[model samples]
Target: MSVMQGDGRLKSQRFRQAREGDWKRLERLMDKAEKGSARRLSDEEILAIPVLYRSTLSALSVARETSLDRALIGYLETLCARAYFFVYGSRSTLMGKLGAFFRRDWPMAVRALWRETFASGLLMLGGAIAAAVLVGQEPDWFYAFVPAEMASGRDPAASTETLRATLAGEDTSAGLSAFATFLFTHNARIAILAFALGFALCIPTGLLVLYNGATLGAFVTLFASRGLGVEVGGWLLIHGVTELFAVILAGAGGLRIGWAIAFPGDRDRLDAAADAGRTAATVIAGVVVMLFVAGLLEGFGRQLIESTPIRYAVAGTSALIWGLYFYGPRRRPAHV
Candidate 1:
């Protein structure tokens, strides 16, 4: 036989052997191929590998029987990496999760907020009212609710005068600005502490939030019955709506951490807490933004509006807007 014909036959035999996983023959062909001879696989080809416990076994079978199609395996790896990116990557995945949360998880968040607010805060209101009633029956008992220094500011007969003074000049722009700034910073720190304390367990943080709400309720009720209700309510509504809501949200976050520790659902306590923390952090991020806005309004707007009717109008509008946005419809399909 001619030398050229003999070489042709040798090449054909090598090709057949390579198809059967003859590594020696396959290596020879790889060496003979031109530089950069690797083929790219499509996305569909990559996704064809069933993602399961048996996936590695299946890929191995293909490799051993089919001359090790590295392209296919590479494709599968790429697909997996992409899936992981979508689920956990910092940017796209986080945005997607946020979208899902606003659309799907918002309702759950609202429900949690409502549950915590009423169930927890209501007790404080009741306690304050009971305290007030007792104080009426036993005049000396007023000291229990009002600290000595605060009592000087809590004269029952001074409500009208106090409100008028506040409207006139007591809570001037500079005073309001300083007070609002202090309150904002103080409250934010407390909220963070409440959330962080949940790591110790959930109950402590919950009690802290409840106690805070109770203090506010008692304080407000005292002013309300003193005839400063309209003025005090107006002042609070200007910024209290957002500030109080943030506090409630922080409590909910703590509850989430506590629930993870106490219940854990389908995961171990640590894992559950980590997952819950992610969601809670998202909620807190939103809350922090709101607190900043509230601080601005309280500092700037609260002092500008002097007329009671005008203050009430602004306060009422603010309350309504907050109510609708937070408890309003979820951003996405409820099923998700």
Candidate 2:
């Protein structure tokens, strides 16, 4: 045992002696950079930062594998961390970061979770289709699918004239602000809930999305029953495209985290969850903006535009713009 200990000590000492030059070089560079700024670094030193960081990381790994002395391991770990921050961490201004987030970080994050987003969207669609068909077959099913408070007195038994009046914004113009506020708060709440519940393995997220879709489906059936389906479709789509898409993105965020929690692959569960949270959080940020857009359309525009064609046109335009924003050609962050 004493011989083994001696050999270990000798090896660690030899290792340090061989690599001390690089370690001191890194230390000097870090000190110099911190004294002024990374921007002050010469081009050659700036280029060396990543190379040195990677080499230090490699050294750390080897030290751990070889079971080097804990003190040496600790020093290497600290050096590697500092190097990582200097090389990869952002030192940009807040505006610069925000610009990059919208330009690249968000879109890349969204693209990373396309599978989860697709699944979330399909769940909502299934619920919508199911509720639409069931409620159309039995009008009372509307009551079951849509809560009375949200119904706002428009039920299956209401006369066609009453329903048509609502769609034409005749009696509903005064309620536009309240309507927009309500939808904004409601969708925002659902999106947040979906993301928060993702730690529960996404079951709650899926169910919440499905319930939202079903409510819409039932609402559509009521309009169809009165032969006002086309009118109601226009009213809903004016903002529904953005609102619904926002909700789905929220669900995708939650699901991404939940999946990471449930199946962390080779990474640590906590680490995996953290990684997923970063990406998911980015999507959620964009979801808030989308909900704001939806709210504006629902509250203000919906009240002014009573023409079915105009309503459809507005909805189409919003959808097209959103499509281009999320799925458009890529661009490197200008200032990132």
Candidate 3:
């Protein structure tokens, strides 16, 4: 063996003979090497120590009798040194942990499904606005966006007493179930289309979300003009704030992916697009979850609560949850 290997082996043997309680020799030897030499320990050296030592000896084991109980000391030193070099020592450990969460964590699962939530919410809002505008300007425009059934229900000719009877009663479980099921399926379909169509997804999604926004804008505007705006605003604001924001966020996520493919800087279009898709998906998942929560509030909370303050409370709470999950401090797991 070369002189350096000979010296290491000889010193290792000497270390084994030292009092087990005296770590001075081991410390001196480590200190004598380059200041950061631990960072450069070979992968082979690290792997071999673990394999050779197994359980009976520390990773720093040497075949020699020690007067001192240095075996444990040596083993600990070696193990820690290797860890400090390869695992926790690397700053990317935190990032790796985050990636794992996104892949395996429960919160990440909810986030993953958010895109769908936003898509459906936006579509509903858009259609509502477009129909409202048409109804206001042409009185016939409402027919284009409002399904025939909904229009028939809202018809002025319908008995005022009958309309009150329908709107005033306790919301039926059947109605809530139907709405929830519809929202879930509809939202998922929109999210998939948003992700799949790339940039092309933007136009349809945007139109949908915008149509909703306009419908809402018009709804409140008309109600206010008719002196019922305060009541209408109170009711819609309870959930509208959270639901609308979620839809916009989802639309932005879709656009983000689409633009990446359309204008991939330097990287091949496919690669750039793929990279964009990954980030967009991460962001979109958060949006979908927000929408789902919003839908629950809109479908159930809005229908059940006639009080304005209660409605705002629900809206505010939903918004708060969204802010906390996506933008709040990420709980980083401890590294092994």
- Clash statistics: count for each candidate: 2, 0, 13
Tell me the alpha-carbon RMSD of every candidate: 8.9, 7.5, 11.1
Ranking by lDDT: 2, 1, 3
Which prediction has the highest lDDT against the true structure?
2
Which 10 consecutive residues of model 1 have the lowest summed lDDT?
25-34
**lDDT of each residue in 1-336, candidate 1, tens digit only:** 689767756654554354434232323333332143223423533333233213433544554465434554464354444434433445435789877666556546556556554543554445556666665565455555555543446544455566346543234567777866876787788678767777767777776675665455555666666667777777767777777777777777777777688888778878988888887776777777677877876667776766667767876787787777777664554574
Tens digit of per-residue lDDT, candidate 2, span 104-179: 8888888898999999999899888999999978888889889888888889878999888878663465577878
lDDT of 3 by residue, 1-336 (tens): 699767866776665456433333334434533365655656665454344334224434433243233555556557447444443345445889777655445354335436644554556565666656565665444444445543436443445454444433256978886775675555556555555555673566566555555555544444444445556665666656665665565665666566677778899988977876776676566656666766776667777887766766766786787667654667676799
131: Cα error in model 3, Å: 6.8
The CA lDDT of each predicted structure is 0.61, 0.89, 0.56
Model 1: how far residue 177 lies from native, Å = 3.0
Best by TM-score: 2
How many times do residue backbones clash in model 3? Answer: 13
